[model samples]
Target: MTFKHSIKTALGGLHSNTSRSILTILGIVIGITAIMLVLSLGAGAQNLILSQIQGMGSKTIVTVPGRQPSGPSDFANVFLDSLKERDLQSIRNKANVPFAEDVMPVVFGSVRLSYQNETYQSTVLGGGSAESNNVMSDIFDIYPEQGSFFTASDVLSKASVAVIGDKIREKLFGDIDPIGKKVRVKDKTFQVIGVLGRKGQVSFFNFDDMILVPYTTAGQYLLGRKYFDRIIVSAVSEETIRTTVNDIEMTLRANHGITDPEKDDFFVETQADLADRLKTITTALTLFLSGVAGISLFVGGVGIMNIMLVSVTERTREIGLRKAVGATNSDILTQFLFEAVLLTSLGGLIGITLGSSLSFIISFIISKFALASWSFSFPYLGAGLGLLVSAFVGLVFGLYPARKASQKAPIDALRYE
Candidate 1:
């Protein structure tokens, strides 16, 4: 009888039933804290959506405006009035393919900007040329801490000139200096030349609550019409992203006259198809929350097989005084399989430290805004898969109650009572 005296007589029979070994290790500590808080909140929401899609410029390529998928009101009538400007001059005559510098055409809405009396509603867009502010300075890398971003003759003279963003210059010039201020917006005004810089935020896109303007004052006085919902191109390198997406899909399928390419309406997409659609939606939500944390480790291995069948019916006279003192049958089946693998490896090390502190409090509420930074270590591959599957589910449910308390015997367990 030695594997350290059968683990100090199976931890002195679990400290003489300390509240039934803490209620049979509360289902392996709630199935290893719900599979380590669903694999650390699905690997911190796919590392904060691949760091906000590589901070919005993963070799950018977007295009939108694709309808007739047969429904959803054909993507709301291709978002009303289906994309135009000769399909943005068939993406600027596929600007002779390869490393085709920039290409624009955006169009957007949501108004109410104001100033004196500080209004703030937001979102305004418009853009195009001044190489769409170098594709919004490589998708919000930065530029304009306060003035100047419009020119391609200020979008060919529709100039009311604008650029604002750092949260609409702190809700209309707070720390003052919003260039040569003027604000207003749909009701017309404008002027605040520039102020972007601080670009933070992605999912729920808040590159500092926008404003921009220009594409001819969003096609004459805020969307009077002249359609365009998306288009932002940009290549200049990355080895001419597949010959600039096959010359902007063969110059928008020969300027929308569409000689087939699935009846071309428009709809490109790249960055390796947005990182395989966000790693197939974070690997199907981390295998559906690790199959609901493997049903709480299969209900904590059926509560360690019903407390090792009520510890072989309350230790029949201590297995007949350890088989009348000679102690054999593999030392009472290794003291009830080392007291059900030391109570499910101390309930899988306190459910991997309370599931890695609930995936670091949901990655500190999404790193307050710069997105993704969720952590989850303690994965010695989930602590060697919770110590070899909670000690092989306590040696297969304490092996038929430790082989029925080592095959009964020393005279029917000293005539069990």
Candidate 2:
């Protein structure tokens, strides 16, 4: 038979069992959709994280205190112990530290802030110096909209001043200017020295939603804790970044005591390092999701086989009549097997279209709100490849039933109910 004739005959056979064909296709559709959605989400999240890291400034370095081990599974509780007041002074004074510009220890945690009748929960960051402006600019890249960042004098005097994130500004002050207005952190009141420029969400972290205050004030008044959770340092120039990071690591390792790498208390990472790691993690997650989604294709193929078997039984008399009319055994087998492959291939096409559409919708949402570059909708090659596999599966599993139909005795089949 010509290819066109084979396709026409296969399609007619499919239509004869519309409800069964529809049910079988549903399985493939679900499997493909799950695979597409998971891969898109993983890719979107990876892009979001990298963009946030890059925005922190290309050459910047961030050192966070690793979790102090209390025991296994309590790993999340570990954070850098306070860099002692004297140690912080020493770091600030290190002259050979390339660029030797600014070193600020930041204390951050969840807290409540209140202004007049308005109250809100917010993340509070307490650390500021003239050098802090450079570090913050490079990392968060947010500048003051009004007033100014806290001064060196402010850090020295432990001034009661704060730089508010845009979210807190909107919540507390609304249309009114927030600079110079007093807001309470925990219980003590501090004047808002500046309002930070609007920065949209980055890497799942929202810069527009935090509050910055003098580290000394935070140590003395709000938390009454001497230790800092994290420390941020800024270099004078791009050329000084690598040397500065090396010097800072050596200084910290010495201060922490042991020379062994395993005993080291802190982790020093650059933005580029972080982006690479995130990419690897997202790739793994995407593959895992795709594997899980492929399960539905197997189930769909099985449904096709079962339905084909039933079709063969129902058309026994027809098979016999065809044989009597000079149709060869191969022709009878080809007709039934062709029906199965056509059903699966059509389902595969529909699945590919729907799955791609869902991925694009999710990608659109991620780009719009997450400040990441938008990605164009692309066909999932895996899904298309999976369709071909599904067709093969139908061809293989449908053969046995088709051959059994071809073997039926003409007289016996014609006499059956």
Count clashing residue pairs per candidate: 1, 2
Segments in model 1 whose C-alpha atoms lie over 4 Å from true places: 1-12, 16-38, 43-61, 64-87, 91-154, 158-160, 167-174, 177-206, 209-276, 279-281, 284-320, 325-338, 360-362, 365-392, 396-417
Model 1 over residues 1-417: C-alpha lDDT tens digits?
668889999999889888888888787778778777776677666666677667657667777777535446566445345578776765666444546567777778787888888787878878757544465665546577766688777787788888877877876777888888787786888888788877666533565787877776777797687887777677876777777877887777776677877666766776667767778878788778777777767777777778778778778888888789899888998898899888888888888787788777766765654453444334457656866777787788778888888888878878878
* Model 2 CA RMSD to the hidden true structure, in angstroms: 3.6
Residues 1-417 of candidate 2: C-alpha lDDT, one tens digit per residue? 666776776788788889978886777667766766676666666766677778766666666777434358757655457366655665676663556566777787788999999999998777765444455555566788887888767887888888888889999899998877899899888899888878766543566888887788887888777877666666777787888877877777777774886665676666676788778778887887788878887887777778778888888888788778877777777888888777777777777777778878778776677644656445466666767866886788778887887788888888878
As a whole number from 0 to 100, the lDDT of residue 286 in candidate 2 is 81
User: What local lDDT does model 2 show for residue 314?
Assistant: 88
- Give the poorly placed runs of model 2, Cα more than 4 Å off: 67-79, 82-102, 130-133, 233-247, 325-333, 359-379, 392-415
Question: Each prediction's Cα RMSD?
Answer: 14.5, 3.6
Weakest 10 consecutive residues of candidate 1 by summed lDDT: 370-379
Model 1, residue 394: C-alpha shift (Å): 2.8
In model 2, pairs of residues that clash are 67-78, 68-78
lDDT (CA) for every model shown?
A: 0.74, 0.74
